[model samples]
Target: MNVLLVSRGSTHHGGHDAIHRLAAAATETTGVPVRACFLDGAEPSLHAALDAVPEHCEVLLVATHLPPDRYLDTWIRRAVAHWRSTRGRRARILVAAPLATQPALVTAVGDAITGEHTTLDGNPGPFRSPAWSQITRHRRHVLVCRGPRCTAYGADHVAATLGNRLKEHGLGDDVLVTATGCLFPCNLGPLVVVYPDDTWYEHVDAGLAVRITDEHLRDSMPVDGRRPRDSPPL
Candidate 1:
């Protein structure tokens, strides 16, 4: 048997380091092969973890979220099933209950709050800063979804490719890119939403990202069939 600890993943370096450290500690403590996987924003995705599992082994997926995401708890099974069907089942995958469902967390939080932890002595600074107002004006802005489903569907590469293509086309000054969390209708994930036009693109890939950057952003022509027909007014 093996263990895969699943977290929501992090956008920063420290979070990835912490996940590996915890996985290593768990492996040493249990003598079971342990690995870390994420829904988005990092490498070693759930499918990748499954790929590394020994053939026919019983693999346990442990959900490590602190506050508990019910959506994740539900979607995980469907995601794994899809992986299994597409890649051929190599192991028996089982998902453990989320961390929040454990009764011990209540006691843990209560005990933690009792400790005298250090606190800041005073207000850090003014709410507003001059640097914030100094941002360059841009014609269009894009929000790329980095949520679980979108990540699994390859949003990272899409975002990277779009940025690179924009730079190549010398349109970086005219377009701004940002990565955001879950933008649902995950069925059409790897989504990219462009504004002030308010166009939402579905099932975006690296190639499509580049095309969108060239046609919609640079040439000011929206890509055909990106926006859903049934989309409600925003």
Candidate 2:
């Protein structure tokens, strides 16, 4: 067995520690060659780590935290495709928690490979297609930009306020609020994006945040006037 561990930093802690722990355990249990990939924006590409996997080794991808949706999906698909095309049919794919919880990951891997999606037992229905869609539809997404300029202005307060308000509204589970490093437009100090419509807001404050919850989040109204011209593609 050839195990490949990949992890990124999370809101709570960096994923490197968890990846190392898993690699150690796998090496002990299966005596397999374990390769680890720890990304902190200051490390090498994951491909470098994948390239280190020994020949004819079954690949296990473990993620300690949820990764950016777009990038993770693309990588997993590419990996599976490469394995299928070059490594024969003996290659097996396994993912650990957090990434395992992501519907997109499960769907992409399941669609690309053969075999049931199981944790330790039967298939995890929660990770199945329909269930995954429902979970995603209801999962709240909050993106806060804490770019250098934004941090200088007050992006930290914006993130804290949003998180506090979400908890107060009893919508914490339905909301995923995060303060990201940058969203470009460094001049715009504080910025936020609320999905599934990807509504962008600039110069956000507490009062505006409340309105966001009530009008846009609660009532589903479109955010007015603050959308960015270079907003991420839908």
* Each model's lDDT: 0.83, 0.60
| Residues 1-234 of candidate 1: C-alpha lDDT, one tens digit per residue | 999998776647688888889999999999998888877766677877887887899999998777778766776786688778878876778888778878888888998899678877888888998889897799899999988788877886887889889999998788888888887788888899999888888999888898899899989989963555567766
In the order shown, the candidates' Cα RMSDs to the true structure are 4.0, 14.6
Per-candidate total of colliding backbone pairs: 0, 0
TM per candidate comes to 0.73, 0.40
Segments in model 1 whose C-alpha atoms lie over 4 Å from true places: 10-13, 101-119, 122-127, 133-136, 164-173, 218-225, 228-234
Clashing pairs in 2: none
